[model samples]
Target: MALAMTDASMTDATITLPAIAPRHARDGKLRRMLSRMAILVITMVLVVPVGLVALGSGAGVIALPYEMFELARRAPLLFPAHMIASALVLLLAPAVILTRRRPEFHRPLGRLLGLFVVIGGLTALPVAIISHSTPLARAGFFAQGLVWLYLLGAAYVAIRARDIPRHAHLMTAMVAVTTGAVWFRVITGTAIALRLPFEPVYAASAWLGWMLPLALVLSNPRAFARLLSR
Candidate 1:
């Protein structure tokens, strides 16, 4: 009699619970794929144009137009150095993000990645100001550089304090900032390709670039938190 009552209660409880929808699983897989594609696209954008530009500049082919070339010439070494550092960050960030399961590898690689972030951010400030197409562009990029360094510093402090959760949040934010370089290229390239107004697009890219990635990271905080916990 007791076994029967228990069985009945179990059945009633199961029936009272809402049914799981099949579509939810598919939707989750789709979201994951879309996120991965976003990262892949950003990676390609960073690798291709930046690589070509670096090579062209090094070879003295000057693929950029006369006006842009003139601006680039202002801090010729810094521009290439910044681009190289950006590429390194792009490459290392994924490894660092994915290897949370392997602390042995992640720690050393993460330290190296942090170095790239510092180099990239520090170099970006001077280029932003020196190559100012407009006051808006200059201010936007300068602000980006500042924010990038701040987040990196915060993450470093968090880790030093052994605040794992805080460190995870700040590191996630820092990586998102690194993707801003790719977003800047994508936005600016699309605008130029479409023959839209330059200043408006460049100015917009400055903000959208970093903000987009940050939003993506924040939107999936739980997943990031899980990774960090691992």
Candidate 2:
């Protein structure tokens, strides 16, 4: 026979539900490592080709070549300068983010990343100015460059003022903008490979690439939050 508990009996009885298992610490670290590696891999695949094309297009340079060579041939200094610095910005942004907790490493890498950002932003102006593409495309890239420099400057001020949280957010946003270059190439490449219309794809990629990344980063940067914040 089952005995039903009275109200007094039930009040005196202790009830325990099953406890939820905590996530393992190593699992989190491994996830972070994997995420960082994925970013680096994407950076290598996209940015490296530009670097190679920029560096190796000279008569005797003898490097793995690509279409950006036209830029190398055209403006020579301006295009190549923008590309190389932009590549460095893409590469070092991750490194700087990853090294946030390690002041010893972060300082130097952050400085280097900032320098490249400045160079890349400055050079982008002329490249955007001289681009033969439609005015909309030129304006998009020019605005992107301006925004990049603005974010970099703002982040610098935040850090200088010891506003760690604001600095973290700004730097992450800046890094997202830096990664936009990679997204730009990816979208452009995919569109071309699919035989999509050129002008529309190219022009859209100019803004969409960065805007998409910037939106994603601002919305859910928790994946890299550990690295993004000290």
Candidate with the greatest lDDT versus the true structure:
1
User: What's the lDDT for residue 9 in model 1?
Assistant: 96
In model 2, which runs have C-alpha deviations exceeding 4 angstroms?
1-18, 21-74, 221-223, 226-230
Whole-model lDDT values for every prediction:
0.77, 0.76
TM-score of each: 0.77, 0.77
- Model 1 poorest 10 in a row by lDDT: 50-59
Give the alpha carbon lDDT tens digit for every residue of 1-230 in model 2: 12455754555553321221224556776777787777677666865565454434333265523545555566788876787788777656656866888899998999998998999899998888887778888888998899899989998999999997778888888877876777787888899899999899889889888888788878875655774432
Deviation (Å) of 206 in candidate 2:
0.7
Shift in Å, residue 147, candidate 1: 0.7
